[model samples]
Target: MAHKKSFEALDRTQQDLRGNSELMGGALVILFGDFRQTLPVIPKSTPADEINGFLKQSFLE
Candidate 1:
């Protein structure tokens, strides 16, 4: 699984490239995963921090 920040960064980049301030630049983004199955890894961080980094916890979600 990818970090929430990673998705946010991609959204920003895509928006900049497409010149649109929309989600993923209005592009269709299909994400496949089970949050219960996997979690993002944050080295030396607490369990709460890792949970907060989940995609489901992201603004896009």
Candidate 2:
């Protein structure tokens, strides 16, 4: 698998998403990390790891 890039460095892009919420949706808000903050307990393996885990266990098995 290819090494994944971090979106942490793209905090500005998330800010743009928030600023454009009307163009996005009242339903969604995007956010980026504060590198000053600690990392997750187990670092994520991929951008979709958390969601994929839930879906695989719950729906697709």
Candidate topping lDDT? 1
TM-score of each: 0.89, 0.19
| Residue 13 local lDDT, model 2 | 56
Q: Residue-wise lDDT of candidate 2 within 1-61, one digit each (tens)?
A: 1111233223335547666433222334354445233233326466466333332223211
Q: Global lDDT of each model?
A: 0.91, 0.35
Q: After superposition, how far is residue 8 of candidate 1 from its true place, in Å?
A: 0.2
Clashes within 3 Å, all models in order: 0, 0
What does candidate 1 score on TM? Answer: 0.89
- Give the runs in model 1 whose Cα sits over 4 Å from its true position: none
Give lDDT tens digits, candidate 1, residues 1-61: 8889999999999999999998999999998868777999888999999999988888898
**Model 2 bad stretches (over 4 Å):** 1-42, 55-57
